[model samples]
Target: MPNSTLHPLASLPNLGPRTAWFLDEIGVATEADLRRLGAVDAYRRLKFQFGRQISLNALYALAGAIENRDWRSFNEEEKAQLRAKVEG
Candidate 1:
């Protein structure tokens, strides 16, 4: 059984240990924190902190987690939009 008190980000789909660690490094400890930061801003922080260590997939996963969807489920257009947001 899963721990009842696990951080929501830890339990979210498409996010794994590495991603959780990255989120932690960026000070995102709770679901509320992630929600407040939003995926784009969160990705920006990760990029700013980790630089080339972070990937676009991390952005996809963050967005998927926020929307309660799988990262792989994102269509090309959706992925493009995310890329644009990150680059914009």
Candidate 2:
């Protein structure tokens, strides 16, 4: 159970197989890449890929993944800011 043998993206918070697929499709392949891109920018990329038809839940997932926390753990203010960014 060493970090070196980890499955990379799969080991990150909030990154279920589906979410990981979306992240991969949007060009953020690794945990390092995800952190570098940050949640907001990664969310934007995913939305752009799907023509803005993506759900807000994906944004929440990304926010959580970047912070190494659960998506539902985000505060209302954080969720509100993310929602506004998505809408704008």
Q: Write the per-residue lDDT of candidate 2 for residues 1-88, one digit (tens) a residue.
A: 2233334677787776666767778888898898899888888888888865578888898888777789999899999998897677
Candidate 1 lDDT, 1-88, residue by residue in tens: 2333455577898887677778888999777889899999999999999999999999999999999999999999999999999889
Listed per model in order, the count of residue pairs whose N, CA or C atoms clash below 3 Å is 0, 0
Q: Best candidate per TM-score, number? A: 1
- lDDT for each candidate structure: 0.87, 0.79
Shift of residue 21 alpha carbon in model 1, Å: 1.2
Off by over 4 Å in 2: 1-7
